[model samples]
Target: MNVSIIKYNAGNVQSVLFALERIGINAVVTDNIDKLQTADKVIFPGVGEASSAMKYLKEKKLDEVIINLKQPVLGICLGMQLMCRFSEEGETNCLGIFDNNVKLFSADLKNTKVPQIGWNTIYDLKTNLYKNIIENEYMYFVHSYFAEISENTIAKTNYGLEYSSSLQKNNFYATQFHPEKSSDAGQKILENFIKI
Candidate 1:
């Protein structure tokens, strides 16, 4: 299958491409909207500031292309954050594919740390993305901002409090964690996404 890893100021694209390569899948990485929209599957992976990333997508008109994509589109980390309607990180408007606002961890949770790093178990799972996945299974995560628990929450994870870890709304599916970096369980999650 033809897979495209979106290229708009990348940080994790190489790792994601490497992950796909390990699974024997060749993926194209590009910012060209036509290629992105026509690909069999589009993987939106990011590891950078949200506002800057959105700026780049908007420049390429990918901001609109991404929302209109019909195939299963997966967003990882910052990519997932960008899929939300708005983000507190830069008080910026986002793609609005997920219909929620992204917020920074409250300063009150100082004990919990700002950018939540490392593995955390995800529970209250609700999507087929969890087909072979079990409840409270640990996955990789490295993010400071998070999508608040909302209607589309398909999974939950803890930082200072329970928050949305994965979201699903129509053709848009996203995860706050980086499955490519999560070892075996992570691979299974990506496999599930590929099948979807």
Candidate 2:
């Protein structure tokens, strides 16, 4: 399959590439609309500012291309935030693929930390992406923003409060965590997506 990792100003592009390499899928990383739109699968993995990233996508008209894709598409971390209707990170409007709102984690999480970094266990598994992902499986995460639990949410995780860990709507799928760095469980999720 021709997997294209949408490249923009966001960070973590290389690690996504490496993750695909580990799975034996040589993916093309590009900002080109034609290449991205034509790819069998597209992964919008991000790790940076939402305002600037959305600007870049809009500037190149890649945002529309992403929303119109037919094949299975996945978003990781900031990628998931961009798929939402709006994000508090930069008070920005996103792709609106998923109707949930993204909000910043409170610094005062009782005993929890802001950004919700490190390993997190995901439960309430739904969709083919988690076909083999056992309930309560641990997935790596790193973010200050999170998606609100909603009808689109397929999985949930608890940090300070419970939040949507993974969401799905038709061909669209997103995760607030970084599966590329989540080791075996993460790989299984990616592998499930490939088959989907």
Candidate 3:
């Protein structure tokens, strides 16, 4: 499969590429519009601030390319947040493939951190993305903002409160967690996505 990883100023591209390699898939990292449009599967992974990421996408016209893709697209972390209608992180408007909005974890929540780092279980799974994956399986996460639970939420996770850990709408799928760094279950999720 011709898998392309969308390249931007964001972090985590190398790790995602390595993870795909572990699954025996070689993925190309590029900002080339034509190459991205022609890929069989596209992975949009990021670890960065929202407003800046959106600015880069807009400059490259990748925001338009992403929203119009006909092939299966997988977005991770900040990539997932960018797919939403809006994000509190940067008071930014996003790709709007999913109707929900992203918000920051409340500081008032006792004993909870803003950026919920480390492993967390994801439940209420849906779609082919979770094939052979169990309920409440642990996935690695490192983020302060989260997408709210909405009609498109395929999987949910609880840190400060229950929120969307994964979402799916037609050809697009996203994970708030870093499946690349989540170990075995994560690899299984990647394998499943490839099969889809």
lDDT at residue 144 of model 1 (Cα atoms): 83
Which candidate tops lDDT?
Answer: 3
Candidate 3 lDDT over residue span 70-160, tens digit each: 9999999999999999999889999999999999999998789877899999999999999989998999999999999999999999986
Clashing residue pairs in candidate 1 (N, C-alpha, C atoms within 3 angstroms): none
RMSD of each: 1.1, 0.9, 0.7
Candidate with top TM-score is 3
Q: For candidate 1, lDDT tens digit of each residue in 65-117? A: 99899999999999999999999988889998888889988869847876788
C-alpha lDDT of candidate 1 relative to the true structure = 0.90
- Per-residue accuracy of model 2 over 121-163 as CA lDDT, tens digit each: 9999998899978999999999999999999999999988999
Which residues of candidate 1, in runs, are more than 4 Å off? none
Error in Å for residue 97 of model 2: 0.4
| Candidate 3: clashing pairs of residues | none
Q: For each candidate, how many residue pairs have backbone atoms clashing (under 3 Å)?
A: 0, 0, 0
Candidates 1 and 3: which is better by lDDT? Answer: 3
